[model samples]
Target chain A: MSDAMVLDGARAEGLATVREVPAPGLIALKGDLGAPALADAVRAVTGCAVPGLRRIEAAGAARAGWMAPDELLLVAPREAVPGALSTLEARLAAAHHLAADVSDMRAVFRLEGQGAREVLAKLAPVDLAPGAFEPGELRRTRLAQVPAAFWMEQGGFTLVCFRSVARYAFDLLAGAAAPGGEVGHFA
Target chain B: MLLLTCPHCGIDADETELSPGGEAHLTRHGPGATDEDVEAYLFLRDNPRGVHLERWRHANGCGKWFVAARCTVTLEVFGTYPAQTARPPQHVLDAIEAKRPGATRKLPVMEGAR
Candidate 1:
């Protein structure tokens, strides 16, 4: 019931401030690219357009992030997920598509500070140069042996990973953020 | 440290983010297949030291399967393409041919209908 379920008892004045946040209502949509039916279903449920490639699009109170060429992650208020899933499923029934609720299967984290990008750079192999990787871009890569996806929020980066690996993810983030471990890649 | 580009996601993915799916362009031998046919299909892979076409999935990034042509010896990736293709595209083949001339391993032609 606590937001720190995954990142419990973690404290340090590190490069970035890492904390576990409540997971958002997540619906994973998988279908053919450029499929109108699937797009309509997603837009109808999230009030947001399906993001292009690895971009994240925020609209109203909901948003969608591109997970893959054929997959999109819809983020919305947790309370609206059940009804949203039903609507999405009903609309996508005629198409060769898959729409499933992944809210409970995942965990969320936030990393703030100038070291945020550096925090992820240490864990992932992808380029985290502030210039190459700007806000609004979503990246899915291996985070210290676990798969994670991160996108920029207002203040910092918001990360999502499997709930089972939430504790490990938090530790990885915290360890990367530990003081004196800075690489200053973003500078 | 091998950076492989995922044709689907258009990102050069790290080898750690990928799962090797073994040899690429395999013709499956289903029911009524001989023991050799099954063995060749499943176990028998073209282990060429030079140009090798292999299957790789961007497991951590895009999660889409793709085919990669790289040298097993040099570890130089010739190119990568979407996994849906029945065989390596012309560009990938040309790249392999350009590097290791005549090193491309052509799938052995079966005598009859598989």
Candidate 2:
């Protein structure tokens, strides 16, 4: 058998730029948000404070965002993930929390350029308005019928959906981004 | 689509993010309880036409279970509260009373109950 591929080697086609961010480290941290030790362990690992509700905190190469009151998503460079998870686990061993590497379980896509937000708006039910979802904010919601997460980054958006339906997400984004799609207009 | 605010996350969760959990504050009737009591707990529901209390889960958001006081007819949401309490919070009751005067339905208080 051939080596497994991402997005099944499919490419995004549209006005908005859509491409997979290959192999980013995704670690899910879950615990009681009120625990100071959990916060400290997260800070020690990520070099940034654990973000508050619906917020993202980035320090140098590490980025951590709140997924829920008791859950957080930590992202780092692909190469740094293993060491970072080990350090985090060792530090947070005494605390009541769970840390798991979920890099391979999710597919990350970068949707950028002028029509990126519009493309997302077509699928997601949440408000994509600038004021509602500003930079560094994260939303765990449905993209069409699939569960996904969205966050604003680098003047664009980063979308993460389960790897099982990644091709479907890519197809939806590409179709929405195609020219003459009539998005953001009342028909 | 009903927009319910999650008391835990404070987000106005759209109906898609929320899952409706039937009636709220049901008295459990388990072993040693009378068959009538068990039947009431299992099958009986107020199904009131107006003011009602409901259980809802912020399934797609914070994943916390909460109680919502809403109008069955108009779909007007009075408020949401945490699910840990045995009864509706005072403020939630007050809001319902204020909105629909004399319309609040009280749960039957058992004699010698805590």
List-wise, what DockQ does each model earn? 0.86, 0.60
lDDT of 2 by residue, B12-35 (tens): 889988888999888899999999
lDDT of 2 by residue, A1-187 (tens): 1122366445565757887767478889998877888888788778778888888888887888888878999988767778878887887788878888888888888898877877888887787876777888888878777888888878889888888988888888888888887565421
- State the lDDT of candidate 1 residue by residue for B1-114, as single tens digits: 788999998998889999999988788999999999998898877677667778999999988999888888889999999989876778887787898876655533211312
Return the TM-score for candidate 2, rounded to 2 decimals: 0.89
- TM-score for every candidate vs. truth? 0.93, 0.89
What's the lDDT of the predicted structure labeled candidate 2?
0.81
Local distance difference test, per candidate?
A: 0.84, 0.81
lDDT of 1 by residue, A1-187 (tens): 5542455534444898998877878989888758888778878888777789899989877989999988899999889999998998898888888878888899888899888888889999888886788788999998989999998888789889999998889889999999989776677
C-alpha RMSD between model 1 and the true structure: 2.6
> Could you tell me the TM-score of chain A in candidate 2?
0.90
In order, the candidates keep a fraction of the true contacts of 0.93, 0.43
Colliding pairs, model 2: none
Off by over 4 Å in 2: A1-5, A184-187, B107-114
